[model samples]
Target: MACGEIITEPLMVAAIDLGTTFSSYAFATRGEFKDDPTKISSYAWCTGSQPGLSLKTPTCILFDKVQNFFAFGAEAEDKYTELAQGGGPHTLVLL
Candidate 1:
């Protein structure tokens, strides 16, 4: 249709999955179904990999309170120290 064209013919009902380490989402519509992957990734863009509300949101959420985090899955702690100190790559990247 063109810019001023009207939309006709539509469907209903939809089933959506959110992905691993996360929940799934589903609802109803008035057109086609969206059973594909629309992963949201970061704090930008509403389409193409927004993964913000998914498990692929990258472990970028930094904390700034604790220090010395060298264990597995202990990144939240590690980032805290790096951000709190405001140090350069020498402190966070090298270590």
Candidate 2:
């Protein structure tokens, strides 16, 4: 250790839960969590269908033949449905 030295680090921590049907993400800062464990916050994702926000999103993604990303979650669902109706080629990842 040097007499005059400094160390820098992130002040926040986060996690993601990718489930078979849905996924969610949460985060908390070192100070916020230390002050109160309940300070940890989880976000609600927006959806294209239905009203109001949801605690999680459908675990799905849309891509082209070359694997270029198209959309995720509700948006992906909508886009995939549209493309399917048009008989277009695409890939869907659901896990």
Candidate 3:
């Protein structure tokens, strides 16, 4: 495939936007796009800082004391906040 050429394959396309403060992902299948070019599917993140639904989630990662994966996105923020309030040791990585 050439850089300037359009892809003619019938497949699903996904994209991730990893921003400094927030992150989001969107996807669409070829058939879906054909039906509605402006239609795309994305997840709604429920963050602690913000009420209701949000398009993007906080770009944060939480790990256990042993460096194991704990949570991501809004869950990560909530967990980290809990740990901090309870004076628990945890590793938080902000992306």
Question: What is the per-residue lDDT of model 2 for residues 1-95, given as tens digits with 9 covering 90 to 100?
Answer: 46766546457889999998888899998889779978878878887666789989888887766777878887788777776788876466422
Best model number under TM-score:
3
What tens digits encode model 1's per-residue C-alpha lDDT throughout 1-95? 68977656545544544443323335454422355435332322122122223322222333223534432212433454555577554333312
User: Each prediction's Cα lDDT score?
Assistant: 0.37, 0.78, 0.83
Model 2 spans with C-alpha error above 4 angstroms = 1-10, 87-95
Arrange candidates by lDDT, descending. 3, 2, 1
Summarize candidate 3's per-residue lDDT along 38-89 as a digit string, tens digits: 9999998886666789989888888776777888888888877777788865
Enumerate clash totals for all models, in the order shown: 10, 0, 0
Indicate whether candidate 1 or candidate 2 has the larger TM-score.
2
Q: Which pairs clash in the backbone of model 1?
A: 11-30, 11-31, 39-51, 40-50, 40-51, 40-52, 41-49, 41-50, 41-51, 63-80
Q: Is candidate 2 or candidate 3 better by lDDT?
A: 3
* Model 3 root mean square deviation, Cα atoms: 4.0
Query: Which stretches of candidate 3 lie above 4 Å from their native place?
Result: 1-8, 88-95
